[model samples]
Target: MPQELEIKLTLEPAPADDAYRWLSSLPETSVGPTKRLANTYFDTPDASLNRLKAALRIRKAGDRYIQTLKTQGEFVAGAHRRLEWEWPLPSAVLDRDLLLATSLVDSVSLDELKPVFETNFERRILMLDDGKAVIECAFDRGEIVSGGQSVPLCEVEFELKSGQEDRLLYWASKLGEQVSFFINLISKAEQGYFLAGVHRPASLSAGAEPVSKLFHGLSRLWLTGELPQEYVEAVAELKAKETKTDWRTEIELFERLMAEPSSAKVSDLGKAQLALLRTGVADE
Candidate 1:
């Protein structure tokens, strides 16, 4: 429920391959069916600012669903560490609301731990739909409450199917690994957004640039209650172009503009200004 670490790791290039060998390599010991999932995301130009997103995710083990109003963040790019937190209330799909937090640690690349976590053995027969396999190793850091209630104390997951959970363990075990990392929902979603380097608006302090103030400053001339007409127009146009835009690039531009000495970073102001440009037209 509070702030915590959420991370992900995506294969540099994803590959879809056969499951027979990996499955056969498993011990007779049994486990339930584990589905393969692919998610495609759609977002407005200010997705990072709004902390909002829409996506279509399908898993081989279940039906596809529409995911709306999702939020994501990135700690850095490609050094293979990321974080994410999401609310269960799907803005458009399903019923009820859930809260989750998670992170992914690409232990494979840690130089300090490399003596045990590194791997070099290659396989050419693996069936990767695109010649790349992604492994999303995640962790959830929650707290344990009293009264015998075992709340999620944060969870870590290894989300690669190219190898069975057992095979993954083999590699990890060889490296003297002792931590328990299971695959789960919170971790998976975290991985998806981390791979994309999602943005987050800077949290301003008292006497600093408040987000609301930024919006007010930018929309001064077109001021209106709640949302100015210009702001509404910008949101509408942004929504229309969301599916086709490169959200990350736009996020960078927004961050740059707002960081300028005399710039305004208000929500309405950002919308209105972006609406007049070709870039932010898709930013809702």
Candidate 2:
């Protein structure tokens, strides 16, 4: 069982090209080949798989098609930890027998799985080696399409290949400074479901339980750069809770976020948001 560890961030839409240029100019990184990835995510119309906190996708990178299943995992600050399984397929279709081989054999009805959305993007990977750590920084730019609705998918992922998360966080913060970005907690599959239909159920929070609502609110504010009503309500909920030494950490962080001046830098605010999110994981 290989669990993935990475920090996924969404680049500001307008400067996506600038992000690519900046990545190419990095003196410390070894730029790797670029590949266009077309990934189709599947699940029953009722989103039974999503409810189970898993995602299924068949990716077409060049001529090869790979089936991937990612189980429910953890997310904190800007980092993700998830159990992932991948298998090669003959073409772009799901292999029932192979899927059943996994632990979710009984959780999902194999026959009902259908394509709900697709993510077609170009990925530019850069290898960073600083003697102590090796990281793969991938810049992804594309669109997530489902039915007639589509949303832009512009993200940068810092995946730890041979080092500590401390290194990963350092790189994540560096990228946030160079490019206008926000920590992305929503998976592409979840975003697809959201675009497919609002009536459908979604498990979009990358945050764990308890402070899931706060995570949701903060994620929205970071992605869109606007504090919505939902965020206000989420903060209010946190404020209403008693501040115990242990559980009040999130509440205090939320307060700190609110106390931040309107003149704060974008990158600093982003870092603060991540700090607040990290507390949620600590509690878990």
Candidate 3:
């Protein structure tokens, strides 16, 4: 079981080429060979896997196919940590025996799985070695196809190959100076689901169990100045059923913070709100 620690930044399709050029020009960057990746995502008709915040995909590179299962974990302030398991496949098809060996064995059956969407992308990778840390920066450009409709995929990702997570963030900030990008919380798999008109289940949990997770997830979106409508609705629904006064107050403050206009830079007020959420008190 390997943990992937990375940050994904979304960019406009038009500026993606220039951003790649700038990335390749960095003196400390070591360029890796580019490859085209074709991936097919699978799930049950009702999306039993997505409701669990898990993704199942088989990626084809040349004649080699690899199956991957990724379970969602903590994501905060542009950083993501997730559980990932990958296995080499003899062919492009899903291996039922192998699938049964993992965590998804009981939740979904082999006969129920079907291809819902696909993503095709050309990836250009760059490695930055600053003596103490190694960061692999990947620029992916392509489109996600579902039901004959396509959505452009233009984003840059920084994965910590080795070293502290702070080093990854430092380089991400430095690259931000050259490219205008937004910290994207949505993953390619999630985008595909959205394109397929599959909505997220409102049943996050039955009771107060979902509060902490919602708080952290929404707080990260606030920090990045992103307020997706689904997130807004989720918080509203959660707050309505919450029993704890302190947690309900936190949710209300978060809503108020999101309602206010956000500046180009991370606002002082936004920082204050995040601090308050973390410490249960506003910083002086």
Candidate 4:
């Protein structure tokens, strides 16, 4: 196995919306949905750079956990390797699987179906909303292989595409968190908030106010085929709830704008909104 070589750049949150627009406007690349991934990551409490662990995962209607051990050094040129091992566990939890992976990083190869892997350096981020909320962002460069063939070419991801990206980017900027991408480091659960259970306001309510309400607005636009009062009212309601002028309102407003008819102006707005949405989801 060769170590994966990559770089991560922190994206400034203030320009994240514009950054998203920039990314979308570029020629489309080898990215988007065709494969599925759910990884369990682990780390030590001290937050040292190298003390990280992870469990690469496979889901066959159920779940399979492959333990992987990884160590990071300065980014190097050539084929970098991620060592992996298949482990037997009493019960499979991502954290426990991550521990096992730490020991097996040398055994797994990039070419096998039992496990699919990719190689690319990418960006990750920790986002906050007005100093009150947090989410993780990962943009990966790699491939998914099963049985020695390509399944899906991995692209940069803006995950948790349920909320508005513009808002989160704004929030990250206002919170003074550096928004640039990071060097490629393979620690999945850096904050451990996802496992500890981050709140899911969007998943719960069709009408309930989302702390990040942009996804709902998009859903409405996509489903109705036309923007309605619901879209505008949702923005107002969210704005009032914002109580403070942050990215939250901006996101809702952008999402509303995305729902407009796909005219030339609307197309540009949609493209811009898509960038914010993509960036926001990645941070999650």
Report lDDT (CA) for all predictions: 0.28, 0.71, 0.70, 0.34
Worst 10 residues of 3 by lDDT: 275-284
Each model's TM-score? Answer: 0.24, 0.79, 0.75, 0.28
Worst 10 residues of 1 by lDDT: 113-122
- The most accurate candidate by TM-score is 2
Candidate 3 pairs with clashing backbones:
none
Q: Report lDDT (Cα) of residue 261, candidate 4.
A: 47
Once model 2 is optimally superposed onto the true structure by TM-score, how far is the C-alpha of residue 196 displaced, in angstroms?
A: 0.5
On lDDT, who's better, 1 or 3?
Answer: 3
> Clash pairs of candidate 2?
none
lDDT of 2: 0.71
Per-residue CA lDDT of candidate 4, range 1-284, in tens? Answer: 43433222223343444444444343422223232344433332332212233334422212444444445332121111244445544343433434333444354332221222322233333222223322233443333332344322222233222343344344323222322332112223321222233211122135444322343334334333455454466456544552322445336445546454443132333333444433433233
In model 2, where do residues sit more than 4 Å from their true spots?
198-213, 221-271, 274-284
Q: Write the per-residue lDDT of candidate 3 for residues 24-115, one digit (tens) a residue.
A: 78887888979899999999998988887999999999889999999877664446789999999999988777788778887876689899
Runs in model 3 deviating more than 4 A are 201-284
lDDT of residue 181 for candidate 4: 33
Counting only residues 3 or more apart in sequence or on different chains, how many pairs clash (N, Cα, C under 3 Å) in candidate 4? 36
TM-score of 4: 0.28
Error of 4 at 41 (Å): 18
Best by lDDT: 2
| Candidate 2 residue-wise lDDT, 1-284, digit = tens | 78888887766656567766776677778889899999999988788888887899999999989999997587654577899999999999689888877877888889989998899999988888877789898889899898977888888888889876678777765665666666666677777776877323333443334344555555555444455455555567555655433445435545556555233344544655555544444343
